[model samples]
Target chain A: MTLHAIDLSVSRGGVAVLEGLNFSLSPGTALVLRGPNGSGKTTLLRTVAGLQPPLAGRVEGGGEEIAYAAHADGLKAMLSVSENLSFWASVFGTGDIVAALRAFDLEALSDRLAGTLSAGQKRRLGLARLMVTGRAIWVLDEPTVSLDAASVELFAAAVRTHLGQGGSALIATHIDLGLDTELLDVTPFRAVWRASDPDEAFL
Target chain B: MIALLTRDLRLGVRAGGGFGLGLAFFLIVTVLVPFSIGPESALLARIAPGILWLGALLACLLSLDRILALDWEDGSLDLLATAPLPMEGIVSIKALAHWITTGLPLVLVAPALGVLLNLPGPGYLWVTASLLLGTPALSVIGTFGAALTVGIKRGGLLLSLLVLPLYVPTLIFGAEVARRGAAGLEVVTPLTMLAGITFGVIALLPFASAAVLRINLR
Candidate 1:
């Protein structure tokens, strides 16, 4: 199976941000979405993950098979690192958080409160969630926002392993993830602004 | 769904949790009413059921924002939307968690608060029963309000505004049952109506809450 978006248009706050976007992600491949800030990278990923309705066109496949990780880490500050991971595992109907913890090198901090972790550690915990999702497609929004150099490599290795296992990923981030993935720069599809645009009135 | 319920319950009881806040508010409101209205046993007995119902309603409202706002703020709501669980089930679970943490406590403590208000002996059982039957609707309806305002910054006020009016029917029937019991009048009609409202809200409002949540997330 594959994830395909056909002539997709995405908007934020009702204003069209990106229009006429198209891409296909097959199993065992990664698609890196490259765009500058405020370019609708987050919006596009949310649409593809089925978290929001696309402004136009449609995304085929990637339904329940997609696991979305947004810029916010989604961890409860009072919960331990392992508790956070295991909670997601249960929600996603998976039980193998051990692998996820080991994948992110979080075994040592598994019992630490998530709030006490460093920014990079929290990011790693957030990224570790993708492993326990038990879904084939990973939709990550700025997944490496606060990761260190070594942590970046660790994330890249996880992506590689996911791809190697016949899974796909759609990552929206400016930082280089150091993977041999196809690059789709979204700048060309940026929607033009119009003062009289109906969508602008509400904003 | 159970996983969600347990996690939310654990979070509610943890430090910085909102678990006891609603109960404390209920207690304060009940305690203050005596001082404000004066400690005349006759007047206190006359208004005890209404005052207790009002306190419990406000207590339930105080914690409504916690149902979805925490998850929405932390981005867990988005991941939850994408999870295999249906949005309706997720919303229902959240409402259930809200009841356990907020509504159920109010139910258990209503009789004690009833006593503080100088409620008559017969009013105690009916007030507790009415709260047990009615607070589920409050939690469910409050979940709908929480969903509607999930995307707004500092939405607690708006959530109360949206939820309070919807609470009228439950409050009317709930207070009616207790008031009638306190006055030693026939209570069957309001009690049945209160139970019906609770069941109906439990059955139907999750769909509305789930729809609102999806729109907010969108």
Candidate 2:
């Protein structure tokens, strides 16, 4: 499968966060999205994941299924980690979460409420959700935000393993995943403002 | 689709202590009003319609903030949005959950609250009927507001401000019908208008709520 984004632009609150962006990724490939904070790295990932609508272009050539892990961790504070995984697994029509949990080193925390986990643990649990999705394209936003060196290594290993098994990923990360991934710089797409059109004024 | 609905219903039922809390608050507000107003039965009778409407309105307001906040926080909203179900269907399911937890229970409990306001017998039916017609609109409107504010910090009060103005028609006809029933007058006009408002909102709100939620999620 190949994921293609053409002429993509996204604006938030009148400010264009991403503009005129284009990218393509093939199956079993990884793209490391690099940009400074607020450079629309996450927005670009979201557009690809179909979480955020593109202000201008469209994403094409991918199947309906895409797994996304946003920066928020998006966990249920009250539900146990196992419960969260089961819920997501059911959502994706994949009833298995044991392998994902084991891959993410979250088997022990599975019985604990997600709120009780450490920040890194929570991030891993969030990533574990992607496994159950079994999606062709993995859209990840800042997936390594809270991980220590070891967990980061574990995440890189998991990504490599995912790619080794012919999966594709579009990851927006500040740090390198230590994999042979393509690099896409998103700084060119940042908003540029002019005192012209009122609607486009929030550059 | 059934799975999504059942999941949200289960989560809402288990986490909906606030619904009970809202009813308790309504009971307390009704009980305190007469005592504060010098135990004047006549005054209570005159204000009963207003009081019940206000109670229902506030109770509706009490839970609007939670309609989408918990789902957004828990990542369930993401799963829901991406599920096989359409966005409109998801919004309807959520609104139905809101009605089941808060609106339905409020209608069932309103007759007792009506008694506290010294409402006459006919007024109880009016209150119940008005609530049944009006509260779904409340949930639908509030669902739109909740979606707008889902990811924003300090959004609860803002959501109230955005949604309350939209609630006026429901409130007006609901209170008017209740008052006419209390006066032993024909309430058919106001009742029909109230039902019209409910019908209109129910027909239109799911699309608006789903659209707004998609924007917010974006």
Candidate 3:
């Protein structure tokens, strides 16, 4: 099975921000979405993950196979590191969080409150969520923000492991994640503003 | 659903998690009413049922924002939306959690607060019973308001405005039950209506709350 975005058009705040996008992601491959700021990278990822409906066309094959991680970590500050991981694991119908904790090298901080973790540690905890999702396709928006060099390497390794297991990923970030993946520049798909249209003028 | 409920309960009980805030507010409001209304025992007893109902309603409102706002702010709501659990189930679980954290406490504590208000002896049981039956509806309806305003910054005020009017039917029936019971009048009608409203809202409002949440997230 494969994740396919057929001529997808995504909108934010009732305004089209990207249009005419087409891509397919087969198992065991990764697609790195490269784009400048405000180029709808987050929107595209959200659409692919089925969190928001695309304005036009369709994203086929996501169904229950996609796990999305936005800029917001989704980690509860009141919960401990392991509690956070286990909570998501249980939500996603999985029970084991050991692999996720070990994957992110978070075993040591398992009992620490998430609120007390450093920025990089929190990001790592966020990235560790992908492992417990039990989904084949990961849709990540700026997954590496605030990660230190070593944590970045850990994230890349995690992505490699995910791809090695016949899974696919669609990552939207500017920095190189140090993985052998196909690059799709989202800038070309950016929606253009036309002054002739009154609706466009308001934007 | 159980996982979500437990997680929410755990968070609510934790430090800085707002578990006791609603109960505290309820206590404060109940305590303050005696001073404002003076030391007239007859008057306090007469208005005690209404005052207690108002206090409980306000207490429920005080904690409504916590039902979904914490999850939304921490991005857990997005993850919840993407999970296998249906939105309706998620909203229901949140309402349950809200009842556990806010409504249940109000019900348990209303009897003691009724003493301070100089409520008649019969009014105590009715107040507790009315709150126990009606507060679930308050929590459920409040979940709808929380879902509607989950995306807005500092939405507590708007939530109260949107939810208070919806709370009117519950308040009317709840106060009626308590008031009738206090006066030793026939109380079955309003009690039955209050139970009906609670059961009805419990059954139906989750869909509306889930729809509102989906729209807000979109």
User: Each prediction's interface RMSD?
Assistant: 0.7, 2.3, 0.8
The parts of candidate 1 lying over 4 Å away from their true place are: A194-203
* Candidate 1 per-residue C-alpha lDDT over B110-135 given as tens digits, one digit per residue, 9 for 90 to 100: 99888788899999989999999999
lDDT leader: 1
The local distance difference test score of each candidate is 0.92, 0.82, 0.92
Per-candidate TM-scores read: 0.97, 0.87, 0.97
Candidate 1 positional error at B178, Å? 0.3
Against the true two-chain complex, what DockQ does each candidate achieve? 0.87, 0.37, 0.81
Q: Could you give the DockQ of candidate 1? A: 0.87
Which candidate comes out best when scored by DockQ?
Answer: 1
Q: After superposition, which runs of candidate 3 have C-alpha atoms over 4 Å from their true positions?
A: A195-203
Over the true interface residues, superposed, what is the Cα RMSD of model 1? Answer: 0.7
Q: For residues A1-203, what per-residue lDDT tens digits would candidate 3 score against the true structure? A: 59999999998987789999999999999999998888899999888877889989999999899999999999999999999999999999999999999999999999999999999999999999999999999999999999988889999999999999999999998898889999999888988764455664343
RMSD to the true structure for each prediction, in A, is 1.5, 3.0, 1.7
Lowest summed-lDDT stretch of 10 residues in model 1 chain A?
A194-203
lDDT of 2 by residue, A88-112 (tens): 7876788889999989999888899
Give residue B29's lDDT in candidate 3 (0 to 100): 92
Correct interface contacts retained, every candidate: 0.91, 0.30, 0.75
